[model samples]
Target: MLCEREKYDKISEESNRKTGDDMKIIVSGAKGQLGYDVIKRLEALGIQAVGVDLPELDITDADAVGAFVSREKPDGFIHCAAYTAVDAAETEKELCSSVNEKGTLNVARACQKNACKLIYISTDYVFSGEGEEEFETDSPKAPCNHYGASKLAGEIAASENCDKCFIVRISWVFGVNGKNFVRTMLRLSETKDELTVVCDQVGSPTYTEDLAVLLCDMIKTEKYGVYHATNEGLCTWAEFAAEIMRLAGRKTKIIPVASSEYKTVAVRPLNSRMSKKSLDENGFSRLPAWQDALERYLGILNEC
Candidate 1:
């Protein structure tokens, strides 16, 4: 097997030869689940990536963002930084808006100034969470919570500020680098014999590793527009927990319950089914099924 540095050189050389473009990229929120995976993917492709997070690079500070972008002058900018505390955003609306909206605007503006392609990571919460049919890329947005509203505002800011921008919305995300549903389920099962999960709310679970690769692929092309990218297929939170227990060989029973049974500070969307037709029409590679992603994630977790 090739060493890390050797793998990086091989991938980077091949990417450069094929694309004929230097792969210099900047990733915000570099320590986050998605951002960390994205940087790893870029490095595997032998691309030059600079990862920035809070304290190092504050996205809410326009001058700081501008200075950093000007200094780096990367070919692409992946804006993964955001205030993602869904429930806390209800009371901390200003902090959420400042990070998700104003912070995104600052990054978008920097991309515009530096002539860099922008890839802004968004969320499925932007929808109203009431429909049965899958939401199209142009579906009307009516965010039901402050977190969702803030993210939607960020999306709008990205579009308005940058000409070459791609807004990729994901749902039910899980990764090794951060707290997610899979980890939570495993932890709960350790302490409890049974758990109640909402069956009414449905959405796809997106593995950050898969999403990172897709984001890298998007930056390679000029398919600059809104797109819905998530692991294929959908299931309720109860169903998801059941699968987790099944894979882990845990005997914890998952009781199905309505969304009302579990009250949260913010309302979750009932339907997070987003159509990937835009990805197909735009000639982008679609992600594998959620089951496959789950299994892969579990395998990785076990090894760790």
Candidate 2:
């Protein structure tokens, strides 16, 4: 059996054979966890991928985004930059809307003018956490929090502005390039004997390294529409944490708590289970199971 890195290399090599080597893609939020991985995957597949973020580019500034897109004239624009501070978004509604909603609009418009395919990274938060059922691509959107609403608005902006758009909604994302729940859990286990995690919320985790391959594959094709992408299996946060401890060979115990008992500034969705039927319908392969992805992620962390 091949390790995750070896498997990834094989996948990239096979994908490279099917894709145009001269394809150019620009990734916003280049410094972010997802954006960083997407660019890496694109480059690995022999695509000319450029990353732009922060002081170099501001997605909120329409003129700046337009000029950058026009100058680069990329074949595709992967927009990953957003205000993702879920709890902080409540107190910073204006800023969140500016970065997520307005900023996404700017990127979409730039892509439209440049005739570039726009791949907008979205969240599963667009759906209401009312039931235990999985959310489909056409599910009714009722954001549970400000951040969700902002991302939902961004979804609308991307679809409305860019004719050629792909909106991929992912949940519980973890990656090597930045901070995430998995890293936090490992870091806490080093000093703490136990940690409390919410048990009510359920969702599949998305490893950026795995998602990057899927995203790169999508960018090469003309499958333009909405899709939900996450690892295969699902688990509550507490269950996820316990599995993390088990995999990492840690002694830390994960104490499960009902979401109602553990109050938060922003209400997290109770049901983040999303259907991957869209990916199947579009001839795209689903990501590996969450457990498998986590194990691979831990191995990568150990090497790093």
Best by TM-score: 2
TM-score against native, each model = 0.94, 0.96
Give the candidate number with the greatest lDDT. Answer: 2
Q: What is the lDDT of candidate 2?
A: 0.92
* Model 2 quality (TM-score): 0.96
The reply for model 2, stretches above 4 Å from the true place, is: 1-15
Model 1: per-residue lDDT, tens digit, 110-221? Answer: 9999999999999999999887999998999999999999999999999999999999999999999999999999999999999999999999999998888778878988
Candidate 2 local lDDT, 170-226, one digit each (tens): 999999999999999999999999899999999999999889998888888889999
CA lDDT, every prediction?
Answer: 0.91, 0.92
- Candidate 2, residue 134: Cα displacement in angstroms equals 0.8
TM-score of 1: 0.94
Lowest summed lDDT window (length 10), candidate 2: 3-12
